[model samples]
Target: MKEVILALITGFIVGLVFAGFKLPIPAPPAFAGVAGIIGIYLGFKVMAWAGPMFAEFFK
Candidate 1:
């Protein structure tokens, strides 16, 4: 359980940092870029955080 939570938190933070830093990446979608991965992960993390918080208050 602890490891899962830690993984979640680390993933979230790393994703945010990646997006915030806006590291350079090549154009075109054909590339398996690290930046792209970070962006997607950040999107998922944001959704995860918002979903639970919003649901709790609304219910």
Candidate 2:
């Protein structure tokens, strides 16, 4: 929860700065960005779930 709040605050500030400078925000469009993040998180979780099983199998 703390990390989520901090990330929101930082993103808001960076957004404001980018808009003030009239530059593009350095990220994908909203839905794509969220989907990408979700994909990355899922990938990490999948690896974590499989890692122990693979290690035991290879032993």
Local error of candidate 1 at residue 30 (angstroms): 12
What is the C-alpha RMSD, rounded to one decimal, of candidate 2? 2.4
lDDT of 1 at 31: 53
lDDT of 2 by residue, 1-59 (tens): 99999999999999999999999987776898889999999998997989887886767
How well is each residue in 1-59 modelled by candidate 1, as lDDT tens digits?
A: 99989988987787677678995323334456667887899998997888886786766
Question: Would you estimate the TM-scores of all the predictions?
Answer: 0.38, 0.78
In model 1, which regions exceed 4 Å deviation? 24-59
**Least accurate 10 contiguous residues by lDDT in model 2:** 50-59
Q: Which residue ranges in model 2 land beyond 4 Å of their true spot?
A: 56-59
- Candidate 1 C-alpha error for residue 9, in Å: 0.1
